[model samples]
Target: MKLAASRYPLRVATACALFGAIAVAQASVTQVSQITASHTVQQLAAAIDAQIAAPRFASSRWGIDVISLDTGRTLYAHDAGKLLQTASTAKLYTAALVLDTLGTDYRIPTQLLVTQPIVQGRLEGSLILRGMGDPTLDTPGTNTDWADQLAAQLAASGVHEVQGDLIADDSYFSGPSAGSGWEARDLQSWFAPPASALSVQENTVNLMVEPSRVPGERARLKLDPADAFPRVINTLTTSAGNTRSDINLYRAPGDMTLYAFGHIAAQSQAQTYKLAMADPAQFAGTLLQEALARHGIRLKGALRVLHWPQQADIGLDRAVVLAQVLSPPVMDVLTRGLKRSQNLYLQNLLQIAGVKARASAGQVADPASGFLTTEAWGIRALDELLGRIGIPPEDSQIEDGAGLSRQDLATPAAMTHLLVYLARQPYGAQLRDTLPTAGVDGTLQWRMRNTAASNNVHAKTGSMNDVRCVAGYVTTASGERLAFAIMLNNVVREGDEPSPSRTLDAIMEQLAAFQGRG
Candidate 1:
């Protein structure tokens, strides 16, 4: 569905007319108890503080705020305007910008082209794989097997072996293959998908397996595309017990040797599991080569990464456009991106905006025209939205759109301000609908499991090594609506465990139950 607001500039302008004054009042109030004596509001704030002071979350530094959407009143706050690390909660801002700037109905496109024509039954030239940063491409079972699908698409076109090689055009992005600050350990994990112009399958393959025959022998490991480039060196020994089935996937530098180590099937029963890889491009290249060959397209040359020339590299036939595939609307992407906390999708979307940014006049469009090395674009866009609701830019420092960095910061007031702005927009309902409903889904799925907020609240949840944050809208029993942000950071910890998520849940529950005084 299309967003009700056409552009963020206009939306901000309209919202300013509606709640500009209310926003001013909300910016103050550093103490929760000092706010309105509404029994509901006071009790809610008190309960949340109790949780913050509890053993679990008491040691963490935090900022919090709750605002009345109806009256634009600040009901509660704790250093409400202070800056702090936001973590994945940063995606919330990214999402808002995408919704406001690109509209919810926008679809990312990935185009396919035939660089060569079919002379009789043979392909006389190369085939080009062009990308526009579509995250959905190469996802399991979505018919996104670019190689297999393209080969089939080619077979249907009555062409067999190609006289030339398959070419990949991924020059759209020019920088590190991965984002800055990405942990080295996270690279082998499925979550750290390589950011590339021509990415597929989320840039990783799934390895499924079960127990093998020998008591301490290696278990059976099966690759989905079997033809992919990842070569495994299995040193895993299996045993008889569910407790021993803990598996770990690893990759050594300069080698495709992926090692799996774990225990499985003590009773000789069956079990299922997965293994993820660090390099997806090599895997894609390997699979594409095999798939094309299966369709009788023989490449007489070796495949390598090279720049796409303005003209064909080989003396082949002329280039012609074939078909184009586009991704679902931006809102749909946002739903999954935010709900699943998929960093790849969020970061890719950020880069896409960089592509949309205007270059200096007469400078001509270069690689940096639409892309940025920092969070300036998202921050500038968010400032406009917040400013429309009377928020001051001095209140926060936004370093990353996904808030994955500790340098990123935001005040509780700013968070509530944003929520209020969304609440007043024509597409406010969409924004509200996208959030996790207490215990029902997304990051909040396992939280507030049995509380009144379980199904009543729709909110975003954020957490890091020592930080926990939540923000979004809440609908009370009396039908009164509220916007809130709860942030916690620098939690004191002995070792690994910083604090329990339950502490934040308890505080949120109390806030939800707040009722106004007579």
Candidate 2:
């Protein structure tokens, strides 16, 4: 049945205004307006099905699951059980599992330990910078100045000189440098940096390039956090006119050499790129060394990297702690991860979950031979947690904690089930609060604007090449809360042929305006 224009005047008008001429070409406004103010479970399902059946999505694989939060009844289901690539929406599972395994108030610690006591500010064996998988340590935008803070603490402790090496201890997490199934091209991008126990600034460095004042001259380069590592080879030439900026930056795997090539318009503004660090532990050590030098503290020995197992066997029980920095609580970290879909934070949380699960199971993690053991434990923990929550273990194809891996897969039904289960738990409210509100904040800020779903949907958005998804809660017009999941895969982007997002948004709007079983 086609929708009546008069019945949903606001939605029709908003849709037309938001989508402009494309709305008429892409959406069946007449068909949508035929939907009535009141709907039964069957009617709502039919309405959603009609929208998804639109010509734009005819070639795509689409799945959706909607269930009533109050009645625990399925309102609509369309291929909900079919597993598909979840993109960043997989962070939902990681977030919930971490919160369930590790309390919300838990904080990761980064500490400085001295191997030898300072006698009259002269003698010290070594200074160890130990990390407990704190992803937030020395973040770029955050107000935490841990490097300076550590230096200050050392100066206050009468430590003017270090007789030994400054060792970086990042043994908490053991696994492949990058997440499982991450594309090789993404390794150098900020979103897929190597997962290290002692990551700083998300294990990325920002490089800003400005066109030279004179045409034909090499463009100027600047690096934030100014370090000598990741040496930059600038071969850019400044050109005149409105030429396209073709600046390219490439970093070899397991190497610090950055090659910058191509041209920049002399009149163009500076461009900044965030490049992943090949060795985060060493990068952090270099930064700390510079910080210490600025504070007049001298280290006679070279900087070194050490694992925790090595430190443990040394039996330095009398080692003194110079300073320690604590990360923001787990809740804050979860919020940042969910709201912004941060891969680094979520991956660290997953590794932490793995560590905690191993500790709980009385299995001592052997850092030497336990490569990827923590990550394995984390994946198993998530599977076990899902089983306890009524989701079949096989429903989710878990890969890395962050959804950056192409191997990650989850069915709409599985994700919706997870959401429904979380809604009844004590942490459910907090979890809901972390999601992006439609048209209000986070990734959803610009989505569903000026529509019924605006400000009424709290959900997570996922996107990758040929994939788009959203899964979360929506408050209906009659004050009913519904948990919904929508996944679209193999979607082709061609010219102005209306994105699959439009269909998803239209379906959500209908769900928002639905008043079921009045």
Tens digits of per-residue lDDT for model 1, 137-175: 766444465667766666777777667666666545545
List, in order, the clash count of every candidate structure: 12, 10
Off by over 4 Å in 1: 1-40, 116-123, 140-149, 152-161, 208-212, 215-220, 225-229, 238-248, 252-255, 261-276, 285-320, 358-394, 492-499
Tally clashing residue pairs in candidate 2: 10
Candidate 2: TM-score?
0.87
**lDDT by candidate, in order shown:** 0.64, 0.79
In model 2, which runs have C-alpha deviations exceeding 4 angstroms?
1-38, 140-143, 240-242, 306-320, 363-371
Q: Weakest 10 consecutive residues, lDDT, candidate 2?
A: 1-10
TM-score of 1: 0.76
Q: State model 1's lDDT.
A: 0.64
